[model samples]
Target: MTEGLLTAKAVMERLSQSGQRVVTAESCTGGLVSALLVHHAGASDCVEGAFVTYSNQLKHSALDVRDETLARFGAVSAETVTEMAEGALRAAARATVAVSVSGIAGPGGGSDEKPVGLVWFGLAVNGKKTKAVSQNFEGSRTEIRWQAALYALQLIAGYDE
Candidate 1:
């Protein structure tokens, strides 16, 4: 199994044991994190749902992310990912944790500041609290996505503690 899948599986098991549930908000990795969660059998017990917000408009409309934040920080900022995590938690009330990802995973869409493979992740737990972190990966689009998924899953696994 891929490291991401194994991490996700372990996280699901932990959440199930703790009687907790999880939700996902995705961007660059698209729905890959969510897909991994549900890939395992019986994941429905712990996976609440997934929100795939590819566009800034969708991020605002679906996740209630502030337009000003998006305008100020852009989609891949830590601010945006934190909002996404909080919004996912709000949307999936049953979930005890939410993990979010946003990034520029491409051969293009890079700037001197935010280059390709720039990813931001956010984690939110039941107390309405959230944390956001950024990572710069080096690889092709596929590799970056795989790394993002792995990181997202690892973050989720560590969220409760």
Candidate 2:
């Protein structure tokens, strides 16, 4: 199996064993993370749902991302992803964990400050402190999105609770 599918399987097994369900909030990676998770058989047991909030307006309307947060920190910042993850968990009533991804996976639309392939990840678990991390990958847009989805799966698999 490919690495992304393998990671997704591992996340599924982990969540099943822990009796936890996961939800996803995606931006630059779109629904790739959710797609990977659902590729595994019986994903419904572990995957609560996914929100592909590609636009800032959807991020606010669907995931309840604050306009102030997006304006101040930008959509791909740690703050925005943190809120995304938390909002996903809150929106998905059955989800115990949420993973949020936002990035500049592109051949264009990149500034010197936030270059292409710069991805931010957020992990929110029930009763635990939410966390955010950023990675600067180097590759085509597809590759960057794939890497971000894989990393998001890894985050779900590695969650202690």
Candidate 3:
């Protein structure tokens, strides 16, 4: 099995044991995190759903990402992903946890401040403070996206309570 699948299985088992369900809001990874989670057996028991909010408009419409937040932070910032995660939790009634990913996984979309392969991840767990973190990966666009998806699963699997 791939690393993503392994992590997905672990997350599924953990959430199932805790009676928690997960929802994903994806930007750059394009639902890859959600797809990996559903690869596990009995995934529907732990996965609520996914939102492929690739565009900023979709992010706002589907996940309720704030326009002010987007204008201030852009699409790939910690603030945006945090709002996306929290909004995902609000959108999915059954989801106890939400993971949001936003990044520039590309060969062109690079800058000095927020270069390509820079991914921001947000995790919002019910009754816990929302968390955001960033990772700078070095690889092709596909590889960066894969790494981001794997890391999102890790975030879910490593959540404490």
- Top of the candidates by lDDT: 3
Task: List CA RMSD, all candidates.
Answer: 1.0, 1.0, 1.0
- Where is model 1 more than 4 Å wrong at Cα? none
Candidate 2's displacement at residue 161, Å, is: 7.3
Give the TM-score comparing model 1 with the true structure, all chains together: 0.97
| Pairwise TM-score winner, candidates 1 and 2 | 2
CA lDDT of each prediction against the hidden true structure? 0.92, 0.93, 0.93
Cα lDDT of model 3 by residue, 64-134, tens digit: 89999999999999999999999999999999999999999989988999999999999999999999999
Ten-residue segment with the worst summed lDDT in candidate 1? Answer: 1-10
Deviation from native of the Cα of residue 39 in model 2, angstroms: 0.9
Instruction: Give the number of colliding residue pairs in candidate 2.
Output: 0
CA deviation > 4 Å runs, candidate 3: none
**Candidate 3: residue 107 lDDT (0-100):** 94
> For model 3, what is the C-alpha lDDT against the true structure?
0.93
Better of 2 and 3 by lDDT: 3
